[model samples]
Target: MTRPIFAATPVNTPVHGLSAFGDLKYPAGFKQFDYANPDAPKGGIIRLQPGDWLFNQNTNTFNTLNTFVRTGSAPPRMELCFDSLMSGSLDEPDTIYGLVAETVTISEDRNSFTFRLRPEARFHDGSRITAEDVAFSYDLLKRDGHPTFQLILAEMAAAEALSDGEFRLTFSGQQSERTILAASTFPILSKKELATKKFDSGHLQPFLGSGPYRVGRFSAGRFIEYERVEDDWARNLPFRNGLYLFDIIRIDSFSDRNAAFEAFKKGETEWRGEFTASVWATEYDFPAVLDGRVIKREFPEDQRPSFYCKAINQRRERFRDLRVRQAIARCFDFEWINRNIFYGLYRRNQSPFESSPYKAEGLPGPEELAILEPLRGKIPEEAFGEAVVQPTTDGTGNDRRNLREAARLMHEAGWTLKDGFLHNEKGERFTVEYLVNDETFLRISPGFIRNLRSIGIDATIRQVDPSQYQLRLIDFEFDMIDVAFSLGATPTRDTLMQFFHSSTANLPGSNNYVGMADEAVDQLVDIAARADNRQDFTIAMKCLDRVLRARLDWIPNWGSANRRVAFWDKFGFREPKPDYGFPVEALWWYDEEKAKAIGK
Candidate 1:
């Protein structure tokens, strides 16, 4: 349930979590993860800010308590309520140890897996977790779970419960290592609860789970809090030991960031990961920060690489032409924007997998050409040259050379300047509104809007609430949207299918928001899927990056390799944070002396 902090970057790195093939970095009897302190004492009340930080909407609204269903937006960190069969180590890049399941054994052909549930694993009501419950949970998910679950389980044949303590999940020959990993990661629900309550409906009643925390008290759209269970099962499990220390975790609901910032300054919220760079650099002069009660830190990102790009809805006829899309990309002045708006904290990102080994650089090599040659006419010829690079403008906020090139591209796309508006022969003015959920874009939007206007394009910005935005996005009801996605250098087939395959291109709730449907993408993704080793996967990934750069439509944007985080000083964490992100919940513990000194 760890989602992206940004649009596409995963909150948890793949290597840090339960891996698909049980190829774990830790052995069977490993005590604890290197990132986790087995001896750390656990006691504290941690208050966190929820809702979408990318859009700055502090409404903190969550309508449905059932997080797995598609009815409404679920609260943040809803995944914490459920326990997966396995858990990942923060120190490793791609590995998983047993959690609910004590031991896992896979078939030699890699088509079947048998898991033995831990004897101590129990549900919230103290009923022992059994193989029947696992089978029932799989049945429920296949029948009425999220679309993602359906896609992930497409290759899974069945989850057969043989006894009270053991179950076997068999898959088709097309099953992937990533599929096995996903089959193990679902939140196991109580079969007894499913027998009494409806699983498909949106309700305020929390679903019964077996995790360390449970939903205690909540007021719709205002606030919700999770209380830790003292008798919670699996606390001593090697994978879960010394985690979830906070007795009470309260998610503060706010109307705006100003109110949230004031509450954090006053210690109403425990800590926040600073998203806005300017705010991190200039806005820490408050009394708490000046007095050293709070700390600001930057952690380098070591997981998948991601980039923010303005996604042009190609389903619309206006963007069907490649020249039009390229013209739009030419309009964005990344150099000027990074210098002034983003406070020079970001770098321009041109490839889908920016700054990673998978990123396509220079001309195609022999391995890449082997993949691209088959689809010569199917892909753009420009892809044969150097990878598509965005126009670089001197930081004067306006560059005449790029503007002239953009003008030519626009003209070639049959858009002529008419009384300050780009009009076609049919008399429709070319216009697009940037759809957003948060008003934070209003500050940096003027610059992009001004540049679009320079090319006689009628561009505007539209902001909506969080819930409405989610609905519209699911239905693909926007003209253009700026979205970021995480793609690693050697991503697994599970991720490649969701991100690039044509099979999920039109799925309503799938991540194919750009509606990309290209044969080359489908082929490249298949190559990545069927690859048997890392070298093969790397070749497929590089080929994917090259084709995606020329074929996919998006206005290139910026990226940040470091995570800007700010937190209170009372919490103690071990040295050597993971290369990907901060492991706050698992490793950070309450410091009695620091809290006393800070007077918390």
Candidate 2:
């Protein structure tokens, strides 16, 4: 006899997936995501140096195993060991399908959501995953997880277990309608394992998980390996099919990018996502690329807007004036940096919402005007005019016109050049420090610093270790920093709040790197969150984008249109990666035949 998968059927009709503003791509009972290769072979190891990371993860090094908290550096891919109620799709913008959950029932008012857990879900310790575990996970993350989690879970009124198989989450009315999309994807911790442990501790202890992989061999700061669970309960699930196929996925940490690239060259690591443009153009001529052992390729980036920029800390009194911030932004010469330093491979970034439909362009439309009309005199006056665009330079390292404008702005802000330094009315020198973990900035930052110094401002670059850099960022102790973020195609309210909300401005470990605490931006975020339809949401977001660009809180940098990657030739991956993400760790698999042919 076949065992039942669910307890009692939900009282309301259950859905297999949730969408923010569109129909579900896969209906109930769908076999697998279209991008997944269900028939792909699953074995062998894939070693990589992760170029991107999320939350508390540091790509260079780690000290703690608990990535859910904000105290210490956590290794990349720590989330692979934990299972969530729902998992997202790479092909869709803002949608999720059940993973640990078999189905979900939405209340009529939509503030409440009930999830029916699959009876087969089990933790690594062979303990049954009950609804109580899910409730515990949410409560723990809300109470003591990273500040990012605390900010996102602020709208969740409560999480409760109705039965062994049923978990319900109720949200406060202040929450956006689409907040559930993010809430459902949080990693569900095993209450039995983490309940007794310090949830806020930065120790390197292993936490119980119910996902397809578990932490295997790990050295504190050098490398961590995840061994695939041979008897994973969700191996055959529709949402999990053909994913997490590697038997062993290993991540190695290096103190710098060049060191990681050298390791990649020595075959210590098999894959690397190239971040340095000059290195991509000049390097890779090593033996691996000379033959065909290594393949250099560019993959399409997801549809989300690429947010790469330098954030000026508004919390500093020296940077409080709008004119001061605008003057500082004018010092960065993107055209010269792109041509000389980056090998002309990057495009100048203009808006934080770059490459997306919400990027404000030309003048505000009538709908956007309708959203901005009420906020007149409250927001920047430039918001109603043509959208703010970065000034164009002549591609020379020194652009006289832009520098002249910058000097005028500085003078208006009461910063005058005296004794070879820009000093404000308070007799304090205008000093700015660019803090970075990677030494690559040592080469790229000199030109920008020269421009800042040319305008009589004292600007310097400081490179610290990755751990120290992360700690400084967490404590909001930097004058300026270079960073990038991958945003969702359909951004949720919580996502925007983590980056630009007033509530998170002073919250430790929050993503509000610019320390933005604008009342107008907060109201605009609320408008965007309340938008029920896609068209209305787009208008509100565009309105917000216009205002944010004019504020110059973040000095937009440069970004590439494609993902530059180099990997060994022994692996096989499906063509045409997903539109929303390309999780090579989960989607690509080892090919024994190809490995033999390539002599790997």
Candidate 3:
């Protein structure tokens, strides 16, 4: 096919739905998400054991309803309370469906975006959603929202309301690549609501929203519930079809996971997403399981890396060199941890982007080479060859080969064992301390600590309260910490900016706690977001994955490829989960008949 030529001042293209990469799955006016069960029943109650943390809140207990603010924890599923200009597709990467906005027009240069809101778009209070609301929301969020929300909207230079229902946002055209997808995904708040409420602090009052459900009832330290509105303004919209099925979604709070697990056995909770591998293997022997009233299931995990690893702080001079980091990494016996501690429930995770299309494996291909060629002198020469792979053990804790290798690497890095202590030329002993918050990590750390001890490193573990743990992490006051995060389903500029960008390296409370300030990484992050096509995106992502893996400051860990869940036999869900989502509570419809049968 021949391509057409464009004028010097390129014209904007109008699209019903927009995608960050290319081509949308659903064209304009598509009835519903193909992944949804259009005819699924909706009603009844679905009780869930409240997750330990709500979104990125610092603590397990929540004190306020305002998630966007920095003072308190957001309620579970608080995001569902308000609709955004566009909603993301669970099954696809970097795609968004129109919600309040009917259609979007992007300038040819990809610097400006205009969204025409649907005239019928209304808030839960029956007020029309206006362009002013969108504009105000942007300003409010950037000025007073949480750091995470601020990071999400960092690229927009300005926003304006042209008329009644048309909103326009212009980009800064700075180094940061801007995308409509980022703007669309943020929750749109009502300008009127903003004037009457305090958004920068904790509140017990109900939050104003424009989505299918609203806060129903809550006992601060005990439980929270969301009740569905039958006449929800956007219930029949293509983007919202077959979602929020439960009439009442109840989340019960427990002191901790152990108490919640006990409640699951006693038939108090309807669903449980189990994370502990040992519990999944050994538990579930109650009468309900024996009588077939309960069921256990596992769904495929998303392709993105779990980011679950031991984050070694390279800001400390001890872990500065790659050789030192690698030597410390070799001491971690992943095979033994999986077999004995995790009950053979996980696979060793390597690259930060492991298990995804972005995962870097084998050698760098031509596209990756294109990205790497410019950084030859800056990066390690070995990075151009086979991707780094962590050491393997024979499911045994005491492996002579790995220990010897660790010792050899340590020696090469100018360290030697002397009188049961690793000492440098200055006679300073090698010592490390792990700051942890959870009991599960407590069980896992002993093994690695033993390995470090064997190599003559004085290692110790300190358990801190959640509040203190959060404070320490914010201050970058730990030698090592266990951390895991996803770069989202689609790796965007925001992901890199928050996690690896040099500007954020020294920023307190930023995700770059590793203190890695490399120009090469920042460039790859920029290139990945600015790619013109999927092929370009893949090339950038692959190269970025390779470069990040080569850093060696991360001790690769393990995660299950499946979501371990067990629930009562009373709900139905769409088969074949989305590539980037596992929407059990959102998509699963309650079956009253099945519940009655189980009761009998």
Candidate 4:
């Protein structure tokens, strides 16, 4: 019973007048915007510029921000907020479909779970949501949250609050239904408001929340308000009944994104899309999208489990050679970065479950080699017997058979080529480096480091600063880096054992920063975290995606067909689901005189 492999495909329908800024003019019936406008007004002030703020509050420290009491630029002090007991499919991924836990109940010996807590939930000081505030916010996020928040409550083992609304928890091994849907990042706080507010981080207040907004005013690096609670006991759940609907919700913080898209094109901001693509194909064509006051949409989401590749550093001993990591994964060209820097709108991801449904592609058939022939020969028999190929750049420009199969796998890994460079057998030379952080990898790693110095392999690209690029990625001190690993919307196996586990190597900012261990990827991530159904979690996630595409530990990039927003047509929105984003608290307020008599 192992058929799975489905590769996805089917998309192609955007050719009647194009325009994601490239052949404009095609508007007619995209009008639907009265985001609750009692005469178009509610309370103004919306500035936001977030590209990183929240300098430190020790959200109970996880992997960085070493000890802090206060360092804010505001926003990150919500008293309690989490509700969604089931609403998915706007594409699905910002998981948690069950709001204030109204039903969880797992235990068919998958090791306990329970939940059941919606007795008219409360807490904005109206106090109610019990189960001992969800077992005291899981024993204070397993003692000061974020170390992957106790790897999603590491086999929990006893959380019991069986009364006051019943909770349970229990797990010592095998429970993970993505750890009970990551108990929606557990935020139920207020065990008597942190025992009378001495909860440090410069004790900012606002400790009471049954969510749907409440805080109502803060001013740390300027601006923080939030109000709309209107008696919100998990407001009829289902992806939050009509969500926050702003009765006032400000955030305002800017570091820059072209001065917050010029304060969202001078309206001071009431939502702005993630611009840049030269302000989404040339700054909002003023007169607000030809006089509608601004509305530039581009939905088509489902691809963001981010991975724009080029990582390597396999404990960097010249990338610990699997033929120089399959010749640097066949020297990147990703169809020339999807037709010149992602305008052709990306694709190509090859595994670590790209676009999910447990990606496996080809080879391993025979019921996936009967669950990968019990890790026969312990993994790489061309990853369970071949078929993962795909590197063909024939755009006529040249990737010449992936640069002659990356110079015949770096001259059969002993690396020789000489005068043309490659070296090794102690002549040394091989080189590599490549660490970048932008200017599009200083323009695609200098044409892929001039095709790895035309096959004699030298590579280079450095560029730092993002705190010296998080101190050379927490001192694994580079040899290849180009990050991006977002994934989490049931892309489990504990998110591929927290990124290629070797016990999350040197845990620092741990997402197993590429130190990849493998006992057949730790027994197919422990049989896809105790499978038990969904056809044994698609046969242990297609045998951990055929041993992570035969351990080429990352060389998969591109995916993000579109999210590209640009708000302000007054607000109101819809079409967006997958890793959800602009629900901007259920927008509302776009009846500009009935959208100027329907020319919106």
Could you tell me the TM-score of candidate 3? 0.92
lDDT digits (tens) for residues 1-600 of candidate 2: 311111122336788888776557888888888888888999999998777787899988888999999789899898999999999999888788999999998876667889999999999888999999999999999998888678778889989999999999998877766788888999998888875788764678779988888999999889999999999989888767978899999999898888899999988999989989999999989998999999999998888866899999989988878898888888888899998989999998888888788899899878888888898998889999999988878889899999999999999989999999999788899999999988899988898999999999999899999889999999999999987998888898888988999988998888899999999999999888777667877888999999999888998998888999999898999989999888898999999997887677
Task: Give Cα-based local distance difference scores for all models.
Answer: 0.74, 0.87, 0.78, 0.57
Report the C-alpha displacement of residue 331, candidate 2, in angstroms.
1.2
Question: Model 2, clash count?
Answer: 0
How does residue 523 of candidate 2 score in lDDT?
Answer: 93
Of candidates 3 and 1, the better by lDDT: 3
Report the lDDT of model 3 for residue 418.
97
Candidate 4 per-residue lDDT over residues 1-600, each given as its tens digit: 522111111122211111111222222221222221223343333333332222232111122211122222125334224432222333334333344565555555535656667688777667687888778868776666544655667767788888988677777865444555544445666677667655434545555656677767655544566676767766544444443454665655443355556766776664655624434665677675677666677765555344546567777677777778778767777777566654565567766666556677666678768778877888778767664655758643357888898899888888898888898888989888787644446754566777788888877788764445555665567877866554654455556666776767665555566688767787777666655445566666776777777777677766555666665554444433424333444444333454445333
Worst 10 residues of 4 by lDDT: 13-22
The runs of at least 3 residues in candidate 1 whose Cα sits more than 4 Å from the true structure, single-residue gaps closed, are 1-23, 50-59, 487-490
| Worst 10 contiguous positions by lDDT, candidate 1 | 3-12
* Weakest ten-residue segment in model 2 by summed lDDT: 2-11
Which residue pairs show backbone clashes in model 3? 307-484
The numbered model that scores best in TM-score is 2
lDDT by residue (tens digit), candidate 3, 138-182: 989878876656776676788899988899888776624534566
Which of 2 and 4 is ahead in lDDT? 2
The list of candidate 3 runs beyond 4 A from truth reads 1-13, 50-55, 175-178, 411-419, 423-429
Q: Cα lDDT of model 4 overall?
A: 0.57
